[model samples]
Target: MKVIIVGYGRMGKEVEAICAQRKHTIVAKVDPVCGDAPALTKELADQADVAIEFALPESAYDNVKLYTELDLPAVCGTTGWYDRVDEFRNLVTQSSIGYLYGSNFSIGAHLFFKLVARAAQLINPFPEYDIMGFEAHHNRKKDSPSGTALSIANIILENVERKKTILTDKCDHSINESELHFASLRGGHIPGIHKVIIDSEADTIEVSHSARNRGGLALGAVLASEWLKDKKGFFNIDDFISERLKYTQMI
Candidate 1:
């Protein structure tokens, strides 16, 4: 497939390398430095089967809408554009285009989320325990708490009846027993760390996923590209799970 890269920074470069390893073509790259207004030329636009976007939060909304408006399927990894998610969904639905967005594209991270959700469901019946979330990322990272952390918090919230909300600090006021605490730390060169800790009178249980580098994310993005090639409408990593499991069952 001919893929256009919308960000030529760290993640975008990694995506390019992964595409090469998979024998896929990188047709064009649009970086922020390229120009102001930062629009794609028709020639570059014509060469793409899909566009893979890993731009910054500020540029993500415009970048995604541009390509999808042009009727190209897009797989986006850029976070912080979620404030306009309803607009994105509307655009995708109206255009009959495909848009797949995930906070983290690592296969391991996605699987970790699935496992955490199931575990939360199992542990929810026991009222003695409560859950909290913590995340760490590289200092250079923009978004705090990381997207994967929020996803995990959502999983815990959905399954655990005790947590009705996620907070950044310990609640001084009386909050719901089921509420989740989110602690975010930014330091060093940490790729990502997300831990879900369940505390109780007896003991504490923690489940976490740590990323060594960008390889997992690069690989997962390629897989997502392949999955998006023939799919239409809005989707997420959750859809990939059942499909992957079904394939595993067949094999």
Candidate 2:
């Protein structure tokens, strides 16, 4: 697979290493020092089979937009730009481009989210089980709650319908939510840590996904790019795992 790396910073360099190890070639890199969207050439755009975006939230929109406009596939690992997700979705749908994005690309994180969903469903019947989410990441991370935490919380909210909203508890009744709380911490060089804790008068349950590094995420992105070669449309990790998850249900 030939890839164009958007964002030549830390994650981009790490992704380059993974692509090299997987026998994939990075034909070019898009960085702010080089040029913005208008500087991207049609030839350079056409050269890549897919683009892996690890750019900042502010820049991610333009990077992904470029790919979609060129009818190229894209695998995005950017966070904090969800305020414009609807626009991105529209671009992908209209162009018939293959676009896949995730808050965190690590397989463990994906499984962690699935587990949270399942647990939420199981605990929905028990109103005594109140839930709260917390996540920590490196100080350099832009988003406070971490997109992974938000994703997990959203999944939990879907299964446990009693919770109308997810927010940090500051000892106030602001949002009028009954049973959900979300909190975040950012410090050190921590890769990532996300925990969902359920508390009740009887006991407590906790599920977590801790990312020690970025290698696994890079691997998943490469695999997704490979899977998307001939496909066109928006997708996510679940699309790749649907068959495996179904088989697991049988067992």
Candidate 3:
């Protein structure tokens, strides 16, 4: 498969390495740097089977929009610009192109989402348990309370009825019972870390996922690109995981 990498930063470089290791051809590398292919164009889009984007938040929407407009399938790993997701979905549907986006592309992190949901459901009836979330990432990470942290919070809120709201800021006073407090810390070059803590007077339970490196994320993006090549319309990691499980059942 011919792949076009839409960002040439850290994530994009990792994706390029993995794609090459997996024997996929890289048709182009687009970045904000001048002279890096000048600009993404229709002719370039036609040369690739799919495009994988890990660009900046400010440019992610434009990159995906260009891909869909060119009738190219796209797998986006960029976060922080999801406010326009509805608009992107509408465009994908109208253009009849495939699109998949995820907050965190690590397959393990995706599974962790389900684990957190189940944990929330199991503890739903136990008023003794109070839940809180904490996330830490590299200092350079643009978004605080990272997208993955928000995803985890949303899943917890869905299964745990008690948590009606998410608070991402530090609280000097007591937090409301209906609120789930999320603390975000940024420090040295850590890849990412997320934890959900459920506590009571007796004991405390914690569920967490720590990234060792960017390889998991990069590999997942490549896998998503492969799954999206011949498909159309809007989709997400859940759709990809469901299809994989179905195929596994057949085997």
Candidate 4:
């Protein structure tokens, strides 16, 4: 497979390494600082089978737009610019190009989302059980509470009837029982840590996912790229995971 890396930063380098290990060819890189190519023109995009984007949030929309315009399949792992997701969805639908985006491209984290959802569903009817979410990342991380944490919270809100909203800010007074409080901590060099706590007066249950490094995320992104090489239309990690599970069931 011929691949173009859209960002040459830490995650981009990791994607490059994984793609090489998987025997895929790197046709070009499109970062201003460490880009192997000058710019992300249609000519450069035409050289690769697909593009994997891990660029900054400010540039992610433009990068995806260019790839879709060129009819190039793209797998994007950038977060924090999701307000325009509806716009990109329309673009991908109209252009009929393949595009996959995820907040965190870790297979384990995806599974963790499912597990958290199921837990929330099982705990929904129990009024005594209260749920709260907490996530911590490296200080250099851009978004507070992290996108992965938000994904986890969204799943819970969808499944648990009581959690109608998500609150990320620090709570000065007592938190409402109907609101799901999400606390974020940024410090040190922590790769990532997310926890969903379910508590009652009698018992407490906690489910967590902790990443030791970026390998899981990079591998998942490369895997998504390979899966998206020949496909068309917009997708997310859930679609990828669902397809894989179907394949596994058939086997």
Candidate 5:
């Protein structure tokens, strides 16, 4: 695969290493700083089959937009810009380019999401079980709760009958029964750690996932880029997971 790497930061560096190991060529890199390719010219993009975007939340929109405008397939790992996903969805609809995104691309994290989802469904029948969770990341991380944490929270909210909303901030007073309190901790050199706690008067159940490093995410991005090279549509990681499951079942 010929690739264009957007954002040459820590994650981008890892992506570069993974691409080389996977034998994928990087055609261009686009970043305000650290970008060697200088600009994402149509000529540069033309040489690449897909672009892997790992930019900051603030600039992610434009980075992905450039790919769509140039008819380049994109696999995005950036978060905090999903509020404007509808805009890009429309762009992808008008074009033949493929776009896939995920909050955390680690396969373990994807499995963790499923475990938490199933646990929520099982506990939904018993009113005694109450769900709450927290996520911790490196101090340099900008997003507080983390997009992965929010994704996990949404799974709980969807499967559990009682969890109607998520509270990502502090609650000085008593918490509401309908609210699921998901806290965030930022410190140390932690890559990522997410935990979902199901508690009751009798006992407690915990489901969690800890990312050892950024390598898993980088590898997943490259793998998704490979899978997305010929596909056309706006998709999320779940679609990737679903396809993998289908193939597994077939073989």
Candidate 6:
């Protein structure tokens, strides 16, 4: 399969290596910095089987739109522009394109997401336990409260009834019980780390996920592209995840 990789940064490079290992041809890379083709031509688009995108937050909107223009299926890992997801959905729906995106593209992270959700559901009846979480990522990372953390926050919010909102700010004063303080810490070289805490006067329960490197994300992105190749529609990574998990359950 011929692939067009968007974003020529660390993650993009990682995906490139994985694509090579998996024997997928890279037809083009769509980044301004190091990519050979900063923009896709009809020739390149027609030759490309799929596009895997890991560009900047600012570039995500336009990059994904370009995929629609080319009728290319895309698997995007860039974050922080989801406020315009409605626009993306409309474009994919109208153009009959396939677009799948997610905050984290690690299978382990998805498993961790499920673990956190189950823990939150189990702890929901215990009102005495309070819940809060924090995430730490490499200092150079652009977005605070990394998209993975927000996804986890959403999972917790969906499962745990008491928490109505997420608090990403520094709590200068005592915070309300209904507020879940999901903090973000930027530091040296930490790839990613997220921990959800359920605490009370008696005991503390914590579920955490840590990334050693970008390998998991790279593999997952490639797998997502393979799943999306013949499909058309807007989808989250969880759709792919859920479909695979269902087959496992059947077995």
Q: CA lDDT, every prediction?
A: 0.81, 0.80, 0.88, 0.89, 0.88, 0.89
Q: How many residue pairs clash in each candidate?
A: 3, 0, 0, 0, 0, 0
lDDT of 1 by residue, 68-177 (tens): 66878888988878888888888787776788888778888878887888779988898888777799899898877676777788888898887788887656877567
- The regions of model 5 sitting more than 4 angstroms off are 57-61, 249-251
lDDT (Cα, tens digit) per residue for candidate 6, span 61-137: 78777888888888999877889999989888888778999877899899899899889999899899988999999
Q: Cα deviation of 39 in candidate 3 (Å)? A: 1.9
What local lDDT does model 6 show for residue 47?
Answer: 93
- TM-scores for every candidate against the unseen true structure: 0.85, 0.82, 0.89, 0.90, 0.89, 0.89
Candidate 1 structure lDDT? 0.81
Write down the worst ten-residue block by lDDT for model 4: 242-251
Better of 2 and 4 by TM-score: 4
Q: Which stretches of candidate 2 lie over 4 Å from their true place?
A: 34-39, 172-177, 247-251
lDDT of 5: 0.88
Model 3, runs deviating above 4 Å: 32-36, 246-251
Q: What is the total number of backbone clashes in candidate 5?
A: 0
lDDT of 4 at 161: 88
State the displacement of the C-alpha of residue 60, model 1, in Å, after optimal TM-score superposition: 3.4
Which residue pairs collide, candidate 5? none
Number of the candidate with higher TM-score, 1 or 4: 4
